[model samples]
Target: MNRKQIAVVTGAHSGLGKEFVKLLTEDGTISEIWAIARNKEKLDQLISEFGNRVRVFSLDLSDRTSFSVIEKLFLEERIHITYLINNAGFAKFCSYDDITVDESLNMIDLNVSAVVALGLICIPYMKKGSHIINIASQASFFPLPYQNIYSSTKAFVSNYTRALNVELKNKGITAIAVCPGWMKTGLFDRGTIGADRATNNFSGMVTPDVVAAKALSDAKKGKDISIYGLPVKLTWLFSKVTPPKLMMRIWLMQQGIKP
Candidate 1:
């Protein structure tokens, strides 16, 4: 007997994760979607809105056992994986030491570790035409002073996803990194300096839905880098030649932090 097809998306409750869920639910080929998030109430809402095809898994991506839960589910159903969106992550503002050790560690665990784990676990279940979309950020192109851990982790994600795309090409699996700019999500406040830097001089801002739409489309096209909006695309290009010292100072000023 053949197993059902499913899409596994972490951070499925809000932001880009939620948008991806909404988009994937429109895909007729996928039989089910294992939506993972810690907030059960939001997950409930997602299921209610998206319908029965969504299987809610209330698991925190920061936990070591989260991946284990998915593995066990795979054993039971032996599902064919279609889309794996590693989108659960967080960012805390301020200098390195000023931020709590636990906060920084949490950022690393969720953004970097969980992405690595989920991609590894789901890739084996995926074959030709499968897509893996990793939500990196425009910050991944350069170091962000006030968001050090978050940006660095995204850097790791960007590099890893690009490399994975190359390695998985022969297998017909497509893996791509999405580096988007300031998205109008609850995670960011328009009044804050952290938010200002994300908007910057280039592209103003975008909604999570827009980012998800472009990223999913790009993943389907087999693009290694998925950058939403021309401003972000230009930022990624400029980052290649921008001097590190100057970039750091510019970021500091934008965040209202003294360099």
Candidate 2:
């Protein structure tokens, strides 16, 4: 039996996740797109917009049980996932002292844990030419001051995706970490609260569509990490040469905060 080609995208209700869904819908090879998100209303909206081509799963990835639910569905349906986009994550722009313990752990649960879980659950269903796109951030490059937890989580994503790509090459599976600079997304709306001073300067911000397009292009080329925009690429290069301490200081300076 020919398996139905599907694309699974978490955080598909909005922002980069939605953009990924949009692009995947355009791909002729994909038979269906699985849109996973927390908002039932928004997911329903996506169904209305994209019609039957898109299927929405209203599940919060941060909750560990959601992984089991996804795995069960995959087993029952026996579907082939062509593109697995792990894009459900959030950030808080505050000092360690300001953020509650629950918030810090939630960030890790969604950003780091969800990425790993989804990859494991979906990999068995993926065949050759399958692409796994993890939405990492340019913040992964350095030790950010106020955005400490978020940056660290993204750093883990970047490293994990690269290493996973190397391991999955024999299986003809590609994992690409998209490290885009500040993008026009809902992340800022939640992250910028309570830290207005530190979040004021958003340099080299671009739209989610731009990053989504570049990520797909890079994935086609089988690149390990897909970085959008020249400014972000340049920053990635700079991060390699600069010391960690210095990079932290520079990030603080850029945000108009004292080191």
Candidate 3:
């Protein structure tokens, strides 16, 4: 019997990551999945639930050393990684004056650097038809007030994915950026920015399952950029027409923050 196709999903412990795992596993096309995350207990529980089809990897994406383990697994198993989903990210809300340099840098590390590094690292293991999905955000469409670092990181992902998609097209490898708005995940509840009174109003957003479904569907279709939901799409359109400074001022005012 032919071996089933393999997929790797980062941030698989919760939110859209967990939903992606469930959706892909039930699709009947994928036979094996590597659910990567830092939480071992949650990973183990998912493994138990999904049985032999799902393998849990205790991975900290910020740790560069973990790439070697992924490389080794790919080679030894002779697994063709048909899909790679970069879904791990964090957010924080702080005024430009209140946010420290270190905090901003860390967000860059996880949100942009890690995503780029993983895509590069996994390239060798990915076959011609493989797909790489980078999770960006609607914030990429415009500058987000008080959540500057997080918004910038997602914007980087959006632009990077699109550029790489064009470059890799010749090689038959597809890259897509999945941009979703206000996902109703613990990401906000557990986020530094989401806890703030200024940002908490944006809570109770769209569900993870909906985002995952739309993203996966778009990935399969080889879309260069998938912006989910009507509100997010409109936001993207608005960004194109609105001047940056004016938009920034408006957004800041909406958040009850002075620019």
The local distance difference test score of each candidate is 0.85, 0.91, 0.83
Best-matching candidate per lDDT: 2
Please provide, for model 3 over 53-165, each residue's C-alpha lDDT reduced to its tens digit, 9 standing for 90 to 100. 99999988777788878877777776667889999888876666566787677778889888998898788777688999999998898787777788899999999999999
What is the lDDT for 20 in model 3?
89
lDDT minimum window of 10 residues, candidate 1: 190-199
As for candidate 2, its clashing pairs are none
Better structure of 1 and 3 per lDDT: 1
For candidate 3, which ten residues in a row score worst on lDDT? Answer: 195-204
Candidate 2 lDDT tens digits, 33-114: 9999999999998888777899988999999999889988888885898999999999988888787899899999999999
* Candidate 2: residue 89 lDDT (0-100): 96
2 versus 3: better lDDT goes to: 2
Leading candidate by TM-score? 2
lDDT of 1 by residue, 159-244 (tens): 99999999999999999999999887755642124432332332378889989999999998999999988888887888889997
TM-score for each prediction?
0.93, 0.98, 0.92
Q: Model 3: what TM-score?
A: 0.92
Badly placed stretches (over 4 Å) of model 3 are 1-4, 96-101, 193-198
